[model samples]
Target: MSARARERPGQHDVAHPAWTLVMSVAASSLSFIDGSILNVALPAIRADTGAGAAEVQWVVNAYTLPLAALILLGGALGDHQGRRRWLVIGTVLFGIASLVCALAGSLQTLLAGRALQGVGAALLLPNSLALLNGAYSGEARGQAVGTWAAAGAISAAIAPLAGGWLVQQFGWPSIFYVNIPFVGVAIVIALTRVEEVSDPGSARLDLGGAALATLGLGAATYGLTLWSQTFALSTLAGGAIAAGLALLVAFGLYERRLGDKAMVPLSLFGNRCFTSLNLMTFLLYGAFGGAMLLIPFTLIEAGGYSPVEAGLALLPLSILIGGASRMMGKLAEKIGPRWPLTIGPIIVGIGLALASRLAESQSYWTHAFPAILVMSTGMALAVAPLTSTVLASVSRHQTGMASGLNSALSRLGGLIIVALLGAVLVAQGDALLRPFAMALRMMGVVAALGGVAAFFGLSGNWRHADSGTETV
Candidate 1:
């Protein structure tokens, strides 16, 4: 790509920046909200469906697994086909899946619905991001991404509270039902407002690679989920893990053969900055996921708080992330991303350590708020810069794939950590509080390691990425 093209490619084509931002951000928010909305509702769902600990974890994992698995294909498809078309199809599919979830009669049925919801999310998220990347350029692009991240964080933050209120006023199913109208609005706006964007020069669809990825991730996640039930190494889980690993290995080798035609270009991983950023993403997001999974359970089951109270406890986290994201994005631009990325996760680790104190006391002010605030602050400092770095690391054509891969790794981290924690939760039983504290401490350690990785991995001059070229 030409230097001018690399720097200012998006500036020339964008027709409706404001509307594009609104629709893309809204569409993406549905996926974000869906990701976390079930956290507060998990207890209620368990009560309603007689789901055990393992099943409850499946309720979360069912959504995350496919999302992590197929997201690359989703991005590739959007780039090969059309972003707006896939966005609309994904929105519609998500709405339909939400309805199925709302009407599910059993835990099995709900898990099925959640899995389908994840498929829609895989289709939605990467394309929405690609649309955003296509709509703006340079500093405006950074600001747009910051705004998008803030909106997503706020939506994620509101999910638990909104879900709690819905469960209290109506029922647990109401959370799923409520998504219909919002999905409708998002679809209408997406069709009418967002411009069509796709790469005419993109490679053909990589169906074989997509299938391999799906099978590999599904098998691995299933193995982890089943392993969580026994804590001990079971033969079935062992086989599944081995099979999953083999399949992933096969997929990697196959992609290497395909070269640039691959769904995820192998060349992108050659960038040291890209690889490091994604590594940081995995560790930090995994810690965040494990901590989030525990919070509602700790509050409602052990701390004796109602669902509403549990949901409300996180409201300040939303506000802090939303308020601080743009400023931090600007800060990252001014001073570069290394220090903020390195320091931010360390602060988050401190926050998780503070949150571990919650196991001893249910005092919202003394125990919950401070820890949540600190974590939120750290996230605010990191998220936008993280996104900016990922996008900048690749060429314009690779935006969708880069975003999808980063998102997948991040979700995969969460998926693994949450499943592992679920096993611990089941083993602890009545002693939920102690295990919860221990899990927080473990998450803190993981997050601190992410900070350490960022410190060593990222460069002071990372803002200006290398020109997109085949490098090894």
Candidate 2:
């Protein structure tokens, strides 16, 4: 790629800015749509495959664990290698994995495919965002990120509705098959339109840090998922958790020792704003992820709703976020991210708390719609700004790593919550309601804490200056 393309593709003609956005959105939609669709399809999958609650949770976590673990390395590799190259490669891998999933005849085969999908997602997501970062700057960057978020939200909105119908009409495998054509389109656009960009002086690959991170997160996730299933701190679960924690601590120490050479540069945490924003990301996204999984399951299993109805219940969230996030992103560019970041998660907390009142007898318009509407409004306010702020927290060269870390944290939050949902998952019919409500309320408090983090951690006028570092 030309130097101009690497530094500022928006200013040159190597690729149209609009096409770059399209390619990024299309590539990201693979992950976003897969997640939303799978939530709707989970019940069908469990029934068809005779999966217990534990195995069901594994179906989701199998994808999330690896995505969370290796995403930082993916970002680092993109910086050291080439962003566009990895983007295409990831797309192809994801497509193949989707095919494998579509053809899977057993739980183990399905899990292997899901794990591959996670690996592909890990490779693609950060680079997609980094491509935009390399192409745009300042207000335009915020708008582009907003557009990207909005497009992904729109895709997510459509996925469940479409996936529910497919699952209901054809089978769960149809959901996996849907990804193939989308992946093909994304690959073509990425290869033809997106310019390759990388930092020439980027550090060599941190294989040790990557290994430690993968093992630590995988072990922790395994322990937690097992604990949820067994509902006991058995020796196996306890040992795995203990070992995982120790490995994570060692991973942190190793990264710190490696300095800038680590897959995760510990120095990024030195920026108070960056640190606080990511903490908020973890808390808020955890709540959102848990809610996403539970709400549909509750509707299907407890409330006697069909998959289609359950999917429809979340339509408000997708529409509101898709419609409003771009405007919110621009608003944050002007006023700074502090207030949006603070207020959004608090509103989400309120919405989740309200949702905990859900009952089987309650009407969707009266109970579910109201809660979803409120949560949607809050996420619309927060999502775009949270992403833009994280990117702004670091220099241009670190955009890939920064995006990866934020994305990883979001997935990690979801992975942990899903792992902890074993008790809820095992409950049947009306019994599911109580535990589900408790989880929602707990998640609400977590979301509220995220709001508090932003309020205290970021200055009111904080923004990224021309130097590519935050200022107030």
Candidate 3:
């Protein structure tokens, strides 16, 4: 091994961890920006392609299902093959996928391209995080995670504004083409700066487990998404959901049989802290996703705001989250994650409760801005510490899978909740005001419960940044 490559955990042996941070952040932005921007492009896509609602939904779902389904396997692949290697490969594939999306002649072609992009994203997200976990240690790792979170927030925040401008000036295809430059930058950085790392213990690929996971998650996600469109249980949706559940059960059993050789080491869930952390992730992210979906529609459809205005309403939130995340990471480093994790979600709940007050004819300053500030502040407090705790809960060697599972939970939470909440939207129909309020309040309840989980479940010492290597 090279001298720098031999550096032990908790040591900043690399000449510039900053470069690693930059590369990872850049790599991650490729997905975050693309995901966020596409929402804005959807109307344009519909206009250009004359696609139906189902096709548009497919355009979005095609990307998300694969991303959520394959992320764990992607992490396992990274751990077994090599993080930097996969990063490079994923970046190239993402660029190619973006190019395909840009040039897509029809809805079906676009959906195919989007699915390919999701595959690239699945490979990129967890490994980017794992690279950070392996590169930084102690307080620095917390800061790096904070920065990574901030970069993601900023990328997501910028997407709407940039996508709108690009779509207006050039075309909807510009959104996909926009990713090309970012992908190029990410690839160059990865090849030049990021170091390769892999777990020898992860040499074996659990192909059966992977296939089962992909099929299960894909079926469940499709069923859930379809369920929203038709509030009643259609035969196809019901069968898909049932089949998905069964396959997932089989996947779990298969993984258990594999023991340590499993793609997702079931033993990781055996750690109380890890389990609690993921449970918290699922609840909080689900709530976050559901509430966010309602907010933009409420503003645009109910409050009579323009689409651009509705998009800008969230600008402050991104800034708050990006700004406050690093400071909160430092706080978690100083005091431990217990208070921040517990208190942060409670505050988020409170903010969401306030958001429930939003209605037609309300001023943006009075109604939306205040809620955004409070919720973003609370979110900023929680995000970094949550990431740190998840990483700290597992051993260094397993960081990729740990990060992958956490990442997958986050995506899955959003996917499932969005689908479920769509039913409420459909049921309410023209009278969306009441449903919107209920969604916000429901999210608030979920957030508060996450705080409860953190308070009772996360051990105090491990919540601290200096917890060392106890492996929970």
Candidate 4:
């Protein structure tokens, strides 16, 4: 280990933990707000720019693909360099990308900007958490994380509503412009108040692995998006998909060779519980990503809801998940994660099924509200336990890597589903309802399968699992 790598976590303290927490939350919110807000603004973006379904899908996936593929590398970069330095750099880059997006007049320009935003978010998200972990210890660390989670939940709840209002009032470009001030403030605070911290010993940059993963995911997403647009797999699409799979396989082999030094230590997957939990994460989150995008679009286009009203429709999900996740987490500690994990996704499936039955003429209170309430309750039950169990499943030293991997999988799930929704994305007004319903029903099945995976794949007594080693 180098001399700098030998410096203990405690030696690098922030001037105040609160400032560190504030900077972390503010920086992280850029991605969260951007994501939630863009769903509401997509309709306006398409209307203004005359973008087709494929182009709109590119807008969303362009950001998500890079974020999902490069997130692990981003975390490693922070460890190699300084978290604070990279956090500020990420903020500046995201702000500039937002400007480019806001000023974009063409589909091509907008996509280029969105892709840059994803790169910036990849750097910002993991480093914010790493910075928080480095700045505090023990009880204070837990408190800070809880505060950060709560703040994130609040910001997520507000983003759609706020973004919807902005979109309705000023246009879709205004939504991107809103990010400028927040990023500006976060950049200033990160530079002035946050302390620099890094672990050179653990910071191994697997550039080849990162490059392969990015190319693989990008190619696969492009293939899927093309298939969705054409409803047929052309030779080009098939070739892209095949090449993506091959590259992904190569990525796995390469990581396996790198062992502990790999960006994603493949040994983590040797734990059956960890592997199973991640598979469940992908299925559940993929369903969620599809629902979130389709719900607002359907409401605005088919159900005659304005942008702001469509945003309000999702408030139940945000509020319930935010308010109830801690209670669910505590419950999991007592009874174990098995039951919550099993039942939660099942409930979400039921909710999606209910949502599929919604008609344009149905009242929001009677149809839409009930479905969202059920889905929110299910997510509230699952989200906390799933996260805590993922952490507890690994040894203390691997927790950061494990969490980053899990986060990346979740985003990857969303990215895949969005890429496959060209049909739904293209439909408008009454024509959208049929494809939208079909998509939700299919996602409901995927969510249910996630529940099944949890039930069969996880140990009954997971709390007592040997955390020092991978549980076979």
Candidate 5:
């Protein structure tokens, strides 16, 4: 090891720690940005390939569906194979997949490339957290997690604009091509600066648990996705949902019967702190994703902004939230994740409370911008500590699973919320133009629900951030 690599996590590690932090943050952000980026590009792709809404969703879902499904495996792989190794492997594959996506001539080919990209993302996502956990300790760990959260939020902010510009300038394929350079850089830095850490012992890879979890989430999420787009009750989807639930229940029961390393360490759930923290994160992140989806529609439909214009309008929100997340991490050390976690959704509610009043003539600067900014701040405050707590609340052995679960559940929450919101929208009448008053009322209800979840799932027994490491 280099002299700098010898430095312990909390101590003055050379600039190596900084490099690790940046690369990890950037790598994770790449996955998140991809999640939302293609959302904007869908229309261009649809136009280019003459695809419908359902088919276009495959382009997006091909990435996200698997990312959500197989994320836990990513964490397990990182722990078993060494975080750095899988990180490099995933990054390189992601780049290759992106190149294939860029060159795709038809919708089927594009979707194939997207599925490959998803596989790569699934591998990369959880390992990002595990790598960071191995790297930073104590206050530095807190800061590193904060950086990871901030990067994700910033990516959330920029994805639409960047995607829009790329699509406008060079069509939708450019969006896929754009990933090449970033992944290339990530692979190089991750290999050079990050050290290897792995479980050399016989750490059993619970393929059974992974299979069940994947099927469960896949069925449930896909059913929800279909419901979001089509408001009618789907018997097939409903059946899938039931089957998925059964598999998950079976997975849990199966684990209890095992002595070797189970896929999901059931013992981790015994930690009330960890469970509650993750539950809160799931709801809050749902609200965040729902808001991200709804606000842009509200902007273009009700606020009378062009798509690009609406995307630009959201810029303030991204800036405030990304900046606020880092600061909140510092504050979390003193106050703990619970208070901020509780406060964040409430603030988001307040922002949406204002947003609910949006009128066709509502001033963008006066109404839309402030609402998003406050909402962004609320989300920013909640995420970093929420993530850190979820990880900290679990035992070191299960930290990979804990981190993966938090990330996965948060994505799942978004899927569920968007489906629910779609139901609300569809029930209101399938109209492009939602009058300001009606939009306000709908958002108010959603915000209210998120606030309730925050208060109940995350409040009261908030942990003290300074409480050091204790096995759950």
Candidate 6:
């Protein structure tokens, strides 16, 4: 008859006596593949659109922006509605978007479709983790998450190679078209293996908070992109930068008035370990995201390699990143997550900084491979621990939201880094490229900035993340 007793029954119902680890991992992998696949298609996309650099940049930015800004909201939405229903809906929408992208006749249409796909991705990512949390408990939860992370790690490794081949053999459309078969398989598996669950009570959507957050993030990302045009502030760029900062501040005040979607649970910020861990995720992922953006082009523009060749150059690192993620997950449980997370990015950043110093006259093995290899080593070492640390920091109830936010922040880091770094390279290339030295130098600076954040921000005991907090 008591209020606390009534709440306990509903919360208890969310727990799982039977968990489906394979289903969770498979669902998570599909989400990861969707993200990594498009990157290899960017060059082919440039040729097909007849759009210049700035316009072509939108193809990547369009998907990344909505995906980043809305991921937390997506997680919260799932908690309010039915996570399974949302997951199925998300998968279907992604398929529709992928089809639209495949058939798009104009650049605008393709970008719109990519945005839809991003929305679907954001929807699916967090709910999948939330479902996983509901199914498993304690150490079983760790193993299930490890499986999910590993599956995603594998997909990230393979997407580049697969996407490159698809682009070369069939053309760019094949990249989008490939997603259709995946959608069917995922839907069938999810329907059969996953149980449906939703909150019986309703929660407010917080439209005002959502709008400010979206506009703020969008403006900030856009302004930084303008800066990439010429690190110096032109009249237009300066104006945009001012506008973005103003909007971002407005977003913060708005969120304070309302609340984060069920996913972020703003109170998590009160946990220093949680906040710091997220930053570490952002920094490491930014480096990872920026590398994905630049490395493909390096092989294509500088090395005379096809898209497939670029993917091939990345295989070593991709494989390593996955392996390292698995290793870090286990290690985090042992030595603690902070050490690896800190050390990994520093190593990767050093490699990137070294890469910035590379000579055009040098070959991949001599000039490029060293930095690439070192960066991969650092990345491989860091991902699992950083991810594990975040998951460990949060309450069981919000695991899905936490997972989604982790993924989103990583993508946001990439989305912004690529926008800025790519812009810088393009704007400066003409002026600096007669020598090729300056381009490399710029990359090193970018890499060093990422490393510095990882080192300073990753100072905490992720192992003892106060797991006693009650799940809301």
**TM-scores, each model vs. reference:** 0.90, 0.92, 0.85, 0.95, 0.82, 0.84
RMSD of each: 4.5, 3.2, 4.5, 2.7, 5.0, 4.8
List the candidates ranked by lDDT, beginning with the highest: 4, 2, 1, 3, 5, 6
Give residue 103's error in model 1 in angstroms: 0.4
- Scored by CA lDDT, what does every candidate get? 0.80, 0.85, 0.77, 0.87, 0.67, 0.67
Question: On residues 53-165, what C-alpha lDDT tens digit does candidate 4 reach at each position?
Answer: 98989989999999999898888888888777778887888999999999997989999999999999999999999889877998799899999999889888998899899
Model 3 C-alpha lDDT per residue in residues 1-472, reported as the tens digit of each score: 4322332333334437787898888889998888677765665676689865456556766787778878877776777778777877888888999999999898888989998998999888877877887889998996797678778898989887787678767888988988888788877766666677887555547789878988998888778767866567899989999999999999999999999888777998877778888888888887886666667656655666655666688778777888887788788888778889888888888889988888778888998999999899889888867865787877766665676678888877776776666544443224767777877888899988888888877765443244344422
Lowest-lDDT window of 10 residues in candidate 3? 3-12
In model 6, which range of ten residues has the least summed lDDT?
1-10
Distance from true location, Cα of 16 in model 4, Å: 0.8
Residue-level lDDT tens digits of model 1 in 230-305: 6777998889888988999989998999998887778878877788888899999999988888887777777776
Q: Which scores greater on lDDT, model 1 or model 2? A: 2
Best prediction by TM-score: 4
lDDT of 2 by residue, 1-472 (tens): 4333363355345667788898888889999999999998998898899988888898999999889988877776787778887888888889999999999999999999999999999888878887887778888986897688778888999998998899899999999999888888888877777777886466348889888988998888889988986588989899999999999999999999989888888998887778888999999999999999989988898888888888888887899887887787778778778889999999999999989888787899988999999999888888868876887766776765776788889998999989999998988789999999999999999998998998887874344453265522
| Index of the highest-lDDT prediction | 4
lDDT of candidate 6 over 71-164, digit per residue (tens): 7777667766667777788878888999999999999999889889888887787777777777778988767766776677777888888988
Winner on TM-score (3 vs 6): 3
Poorest 10 consecutive residues of model 5 by lDDT?
Answer: 3-12
What's the CA error at residue 270 for candidate 1, in Å? 2.4
Model 5's alpha-carbon lDDT is 0.67
